[model samples]
Target: MYLYLQQQIQDVVKEFAKRQFDVDANVVVNQPPRAEMGDMALPLAMELARTLRRAPRQIAEEVAAELKKLEIVERVEIAGAGYVNLYFKRAAYATAFDQRTSGASTGKATGEKIIVEHTNINPNKAAHIGHLRNAALGDTFVRLLRSRGRNVEVQNYIDNTGVQVADVVAGFLNLEKKSAEEVRRLTEDPAVRFDYYCWDLYAKVSRFLAEQADGKAMRSTMLREIEAGGTEAARMAEIVSTAIVRAHLKTMHRLGVEYDLLPRESEILHLRFWDQAFALLKAKGAVYLETAGKNSGCWVMQYKGSETEDETAANEEDTKVIVRSNSTVTYVGKDMAYQLWKFGLLGKDFYYQPFHTYPDGHVVWMSSSERGKPSPAFGNGKIVYNVIDTRQSYLQDIVAAGLRALGYAAQADRSIHFSYEMVALSPRCCEEMGIELSPEEQKRPYIEVSGRKGLGVKADDLIDRLTEEALREVAARHPDKSQETKELIARQIAIGALRYFLLKYTCNAVIAFDFREALSFEGETGPYVQYAVVRARNIFRKLAEEGEGAKPVAISEATLAKFLAPPDGDAFWSLLYLISQRDAAAEQAVVTTEPAAVAKYAFQLAQAFNNFYHRFHILTEQNPERKAFLLWLVRKLEEQLTATLGILGIEAPKAM
Candidate 1:
C-alpha cells in the first residue's frame, strides 16, 4: 500500500514538473521524523529551486498548491527548507486496505532463473551450529526472492570426494582395519547414527595425523584412492558420505530448510567435468603451467587481485594452483566447472536422478554420472548466489574471475558471494553443555566451533535441547493442552527460536549461540513476535465469546472517513501506515541481500501492535461504533502480522 501511494505521488510530481517547469525530474519520497508532519515528504522543490531561480520555499508552496488537487492527497504542506509533505486520504487508504486481496502480486517479474547454493557442508560428519547459519541465511534469502516473484532454485553442493570424507575413510581403513562390507553394515545399523560415528572417527583421525609421522602420507593415499573410485577405500567413502549427507538433510529439514538439488563432486569427477573446464581454461589462457617457479609442474591461475604491477612484482602468494603437480584437480577447478554449468555457459550438463522426496512432494535431485530417471532440468540459471562463509571469499572471487577470463562477463557480474561470518558458542552456552573451557576461553565473548576437533554443537543436538526447553515452558503455561499438542507447539517454537537467532544478526556479524537469549519470550526473540499474534487472536476470541460477533463487517468509506477525522485517530492511523510498508521492507531486504532487515521489521511491528493492544480496550468500551472500529483495527493487525511472520518462516500458534 505504501509503495503504491509513493508511485502515485511520484507520477503526479513528474507531470507537474513537465507542465509547469518544462523539465524532467526524478521525485524521491521519504518519511518525516514525526507523524504530525505527514505520511511522506518530498524535497523536489529544493532540487528545482536552482533551475527556477527562486527560493526553495517558494517552489515548495507552488507545488503544494498544485498537489492539493490529487485525489489521494488529503493535504499538502510546505515545511522548513522547501519540503513538500503529503498527508494521504485516511479513508481512501482504509478503503484500499479493505479492497486489497491477499497474495496480490508485488515486484515486477523479471522471468530470470536464480540459483542459490547453500549448506555446502562436507558430507563427512554431522552438521554443526556453523552449518546452521549458512542454511538459515540461504533459505531465508530464497524466501525473500520468492516473495518478490523471482524464479529461484535451491542447491546444496556436496563435496563427497573431498579430503574431509577421505580422512574419515582413512580412519575406518588404516585405524580400524575395517573393510568395505563392514562399513556398509555399520551404516545400515538402525541404532548406530553413522554420521555420529564418523564425527568421532574424524576427530580422532585429526589428532592422530598431528601426532603420527605417517598420518599425512596415509591420508594422501586415501584421498587419491577415493578420487580414483575403484578401490575398497573409495567404496567405503561413498557409504560414509552418502549416509552423512542424508543425516544432514534430516537435520536441515528440522529447521524447515530444503534443497532442490544435491550436486556432488564425485559426479563432477566421474562425468569428467573438470577435464572440459581445464580445456576451456587452457584455450582461454585463464591458467598456465608454472614450469620454472616453486610451483613447477602445477597449473596455476594468477590471483585475481594481483593484476597490478607493484603487487605482481612483490610476488605475494598470488598463484592459485588449479591442478596439482600430481594431476589432481583442486576444489576451485571443479567449482569453476559447476559455476559455468549454473549459467549454461559450460556447454556441458549433469545427468540427474531423484534422491529424496520431501513431505511437500518436492523431489530433490542428485547429480549422477549415468541417467537413472527422467528429471526436471537443473541449473541454467541467469544469476547464481553462493551462500558460503566469509573465510572462502577469496576462492569465491576467483570463481567469478574464472568466468570473466572465459568471457562470460555477464554471468560473472550476476554471480554473488552471499558470504557470512562463522557461528560460535557463547561462553555460557559452552559451560551449560558440559564442555570444559580454558580460563582464557571463558573470559572471551565467544569460542569458535571446530568440527575436526569434535568441539562444535551438533545441529540436531541443539535443536533437541531447544525443543526440550520449549516443551517445559509450554507445559507449565498450558497444562490444559494435550501432551501431543504441547509437543507440536514446542517444536514450532524451537524452530522459530533457532532460525530467528541465526537470522537476527547481519550477514557480516558473528553470532554467539546462547540458549537463554534465543528462547526468552522477551525482547527481539521469535516468540515475542509470535506471542503478539496470539494476543491478537485472543482479543477476537473474547469478542466472539462475548456474543459481540468479532467478525468485522465491511466498513463503508463514509464511516472510515468519520472515524479517522479527529486527533484521537492519529495513533491508529500511524499503526496502519507502518503495517502498510511490508512490501517496501521486503524489497529492501532483497535488494540489500540482508535478511536481518526483515527480521527487524517483524519485531518492530510486533512492538507497535503490543503498544496499541494495551492502549486501546475494545471489549470494555461501551460505544458500539468505537468498539467495532477497534475490532477492525485488531483484525487488520492480525492479517499483516501473520503475513510478516510467514515471510520469516515462523508459525504463530493459537495457545502460545
Candidate 2:
C-alpha cells in the first residue's frame, strides 16, 4: 500500500522537478498532527528544496499539481514551508483496514537464522525487579521479530555454577553447618520456595563474610569445592540452581516471557567447546601468556590502540586471565567459549533435552548431555543479539574480539551487544525496602541496586503487591463479579502495568524505580493502554446489544473496508485507518532494536480511538446504520490496538 503511494508521489515529483533525481528518494510520509492537515503528508518539497535550488513552497505547488493527476490522491495541497499534503480516499483506507486483507509490513527479508538470548539471570536466588525489565524487553524483541516473519530462537543463559551459586552453597554447608542429607531434606520442602528462602540466606552469608578480617580463607575453601565440580558443595549448588531457575521461569511465564533453550555455563566447559576456542586463540597468537606484568602469568589479548578512556577501559586489554594462576576460568574466559559456541566455530555442539515449554511461543529445551535429535538451527545464526546490561560491556566487547580473532569476523560484526543501563531504586523505595545509601553517596542522581546485599525490590514481592492492589481496584470497579474473574482481571492489569513501566524509557536510560510510579495506572502506562482497549471493548459490547439486538454483527470479520460508505470523507475513517498500520510500527522495531516503538504505536492508536470515541457518538448517531458502522469501526480499532499490545508482551483487561 505504501509503496504504491510512494511510487505515485515519486513519479509526480520526478516529472515536476524538471531535473532528474532518483525516483526512490526515501520520501518522508507522516500523519498530519491534525485531521485537517491531511491523511498523509510528504514534506518532499522541503526535503528537495536545498538540492533543487528552489524554495519548498514553489516545488510543493508544482509537485501537488502533478501528484493530483495520479491515482491514490483524493486531493493534494501545498502547505506551509512547501509541505505536500495528500488526503487518502476513505474508501481505500476502509477497504485496507478490513481485517481479512491487509498484510504485515515485513516478511523474513533475510531468511537467515537468529538467536536472541536474554534474562540469563543466575539461578541461585529469587529474581528481582531488575530481571523483570530484562525479560519484558527481550520477550518483546522476540515477538517483534516473529511478527515481522523472522525465525527467532529465544534462549535463556543459565549461570548455574557461578560465584553466586557457590555463595548459596557456602551458606548451607559452611555457615549453617548442614549435613548433606539435612541440606537435601531442606531443599526438597514443597511448602517453601528454596530459591526465595535462599535469597535472604545468601544476603546473611554475604554480610557475615564481609565483617570478617580473614573471610578470604572461607571463600577460598568454597571456591575449591566449586571448581572440583563433584563435591557436596558443587552438588548442593546444582540443587539450588535448579530450584531457583524454576522459580525464575514461573515468574517469567506469568508475564508472558518465554524461551526456547537454557544453555548452561557448565556445559560449555564439559563439552570442551572452549578448549578448542582457546587453542585457536593460542595458535593464531591472538592471545599470549603474560610472564611479567600487573596481570602477570595470565593470558591476554591486547586492545586496538585507538580507543578513548571509556572504550579503552574495557578494550585496553583483551588481555585477561583465561586461566588464573589458580587454574580457574575467569568469567571472561567462559564467555569467550560461549561466544565461540554461539557462532558454531568451536567444532562442538550441545545435546538437546526437553526443558518445560512456556505458554507463549517458546519451546524450552536444555543443552543435552549426549547428542540429541536436531532442532531448529539453534546457533551459528547470521546474527546474534545478546540482551545483556551495560555492566557487561567489558566482557561483551571481548566476545566481539574473540569472534574477530578466531577468523569469524563476519559473525562478530553481526553479533550485537544489546546493552541497556541498570535499574535503581528511588530513595523512598530504598527506605521502604530498608536498603539505604550513605549521605555522601546520596549526592548522586540514582541509587544502585545491590542484589548481593539484598538492597532492593524482589521480583516476586513486587508482583504480589501489584496483584493485591489491583484486586482491590478490580473489586471496587467490578463488583458482583466472581472471585475467579476478579483475580483474572487483576493479574492482567498487574502484568500490564509492570511490563509497560519497565519498557517506557529508552533502553539505555537508568530507571530509578519508585513503587508509586510503577504501580500507577494513570498517565502513559501499560494498563492505560489496556484500559483504552477495554473501553473500546465496552463500546462494542454496548453497540452489539443495541445495534443488532443481541445478534452477531459480523464484527470480527469487519474489515477497514466497511468504512467506505457514501460520503466517506469523515475524519473518523481517517483516524481508524491509522489503526491499520500496526505492521509499519512492527517494522520500526528491527531498525531501532528498541521495543518502545511498539509501545509508542499502542499509545498513538489509543489516542486515536479515544478521540474518535469522544467526538462522534457511536451509540447516539442519527441513523441506526451509521451508528452500527461506527460501532464496527470501534471494534476494528480495538482489535488492532490489542494486537499491538500483545506484540509488546502486554495484556488488555476487558474490564480494566
Candidate 3:
C-alpha cells in the first residue's frame, strides 16, 4: 500500500506538472523529517520556479491547492517557501494496508525477462566463503525481483574446461599418476569425498606449478587435451568438474540458494558459440588479427580503458588478446560469446539436459553438447546482470564493449555488472577455523584466503561450524525438544545467521567473516531479527493458551482511524507507518541493486517491534479495544518482518 500510494502521488504530480508547465517533470518524492510534518514531501515547486520564473512560494501554494483535491490526501501544506508536504487520510491508508497485507499486488508487472548469472565458481574445487557471498547476493536479488513480480532467470556459469579445471586434471594424471578410470573410481568411492579430495589436489598442483620448471608445460598439455575433448584427460575433467559441481550445489542449497540453469564453458565451446561470435566480430571489425609486436599471431581487440574511444585509435598496452598466439580462446573471448548468446544475438544455442532437481521438484537444467529433453527457453535476456566480484570489472567491461562493438548498443546498456568486494576472514574467525596466521597477518584486520594455497574455509565446513555453534545454543535453550526438531531449528538459525551476515554489508564493502558476531541473538544480526518474529509468535501462543481471542479481529476502518489519530495514537501510528514501509524498502533495494537495504530494513523493523513489545504489554492490557489494536500491531510486525526477511533469503525460525 505504501508503494501503491507513492506511485499514485508521483503519477498525479507528473501529470499536473506537464499540464501546467508544459514540461515532463521527473517527480522526486521524499519523506519528511518528522511525523508531525507530513508522510511525504515534494520540492516540485522549487524545481519548476527556475524554469517558470515564478516565486517558489506561489508555485508551492498552487500545487498544494491542486493536491488538496485528491481523495487520498488528508491535507496539503506549503513549508519553507517551496516544499509541498502531503498528509494522507489515516482511515483510507489503514484500509488499503489491510488489503495489501492480504496478498494484494502493489507492483506493476514487467514481462521482460531478466537474467542474473552468479556464483560462477570454478568446477575444480569446493566452494569457499567468497563464493557464498556471490550466491547470497545473487539469490537475494532474484528474490527481490520476484517479490516485485518481475521475470527472473538465475544462472550459474560453470568453467569446466578452464585453466583451473585443467590444473586439477594435471594433478590427477601427473601428480597422482591416476588414469581416468582410477579417478572415476575415486569419485564413486563412498569413503572419499571427491570435492574435498580435489580441493587438496588443486592446491598441491598450484604449488607445483609455481615451484617446478616443467609444471607449466605439463599444465599446457593437459589444457590442450581438455579443450580438444574426446580424450581420457577430458573424460577425467568431466568427472571431476561434474562431481564438484554437485558438491557446490549441495553447499549452496543449505542456504536456500538454487539456480535455473548451469551453463558450462565446454558447452559454449562445443556448440560453436565462439565460432559464430568470431565471425560476427570479424565482420563488424570488432577484433583484428595482430601480425606484429609481442601480440603477433593473436586475435586482439582494442581496449580504451573503459572510456569512449575513437575507432581508429591504436596502442600496445590498450590491446587485449581474445585468441592467443597458440590458437586458444581466452576467458574474456568465451565470455563475449556468452554475452552475445544471452542477448539472443549469437545464432547458436546449447543443448539442454536436466542437471539436478531439488527436494521441491525444482529442476536445474545444464547446458550440454548432446541433445536431451525439451526445456524452457533459457537465454535471450532483455537485461543481464553478471554478479561477478569487483576484480573482474575490466573483463566485464570488455564483454559490454564487445556487445557495443557489434552494434548492440541497447544490450550493452542493459548489461549490468553487479560487482562486489571480496570476503575475507577475521582474526577471530581464522582462529576458529584453526588457520594459523603469521605475525604480520595477525596485525592486519582481516586475512585474505587463497584458493591455490587451500587456506580458505570450505562453504560446507563454515556452514557446519555455524550449525554446531547454533546447536549448542538451541540445546541450552530447549533441551526437552526432540533432537530432530532441535536440529531443524538450529539449521534455520545457522542459515539465517550466515545469510544476514553476508547481506548486511554494501556490495562494495569487504566483509570480514566472524562467527560469534553473526550468530549473536542481541545485536544487528540475523538471530536478533529471527528472535523478534519468534517473540511475536510466542505472544499469540500465550494468548491462545489463556483462552483469549488469539486470532486477530477484523477492525473497522473507523476504529483503525481512531487508533491512528494523533496525541493518543502516535505510538500505534508510528508502528503502522513502519510496517507500511516494507514494500517501499523492497522497491528501494531492487532499484539500487543493493540487498543491504533490505537487510538494514529487517533489522530496523525488528528493532521497532522489539521496542513496541516492551512498551505495550499486549498480554496484560486492560482495555479490549487497545489490546486488540496492540495485537493487530504485533501481527503486522510479524507479517512485515517475515516478508522482509524472505527477501533477504533469511528464514524466521519458529524458536530462538
Residue 492 error, candidate 1, Å: 0.9
Clashes of each: 0, 10, 0
| Candidate 3 residue lDDT tens string, 1-656 | 78888888899888988898788988888888888888899989998999999999898888888889889799998998689999888878877888778765576555899999999999999899899999999999999999988999999999999999999998888789999999989989999988899889999999999898987778778888898899999999999999899999999999999999999999888988899999999999989999988899999998765454653344767789999888889999999999999988898889999989999999999998999999999998999999999999999888888888899999999999999999988998888888888998899989887899998878888899889989999999999999998999999999998899899999999888776676665689898899999999999999999998687678788788878887788777777887899888899988899999999989988888889888879889998887787788788888888888999888887777
Question: TM-scores, in order shown?
Answer: 0.94, 0.89, 0.95
Report lDDT per candidate.
Answer: 0.88, 0.77, 0.89
Order by TM-score, highest first = 3, 1, 2
User: Candidate 2 residues 1-656, lDDT tens each?
Assistant: 44345555665665555545444455666767777787678788777878778788987787777778766568987788888888776665565456343344554545777789899998878888889888888999988888777878788988877788878788888689986667678778888877778888889889888888877677767776776678888778777787788888898888888788899877876787667777888998877886775677677776554455676345535355666666567777778887777777777888887778665555678886578766755776767899999998888887788778778888888889878888998777777777666996667776888778877688888999999999999999889999999999999999998988888887988999999999998878888889889988887677567665633255332343455533453566566667777777787777688888788888888887777778877666887666666766776677788889989888887686
Candidate number of the best lDDT: 3
The runs of at least 3 residues in candidate 3 whose Cα sits more than 4 Å from the true structure, single-residue gaps closed, are 22-24, 51-54, 104-110, 305-314, 431-443
lDDT of 3 at 217: 78
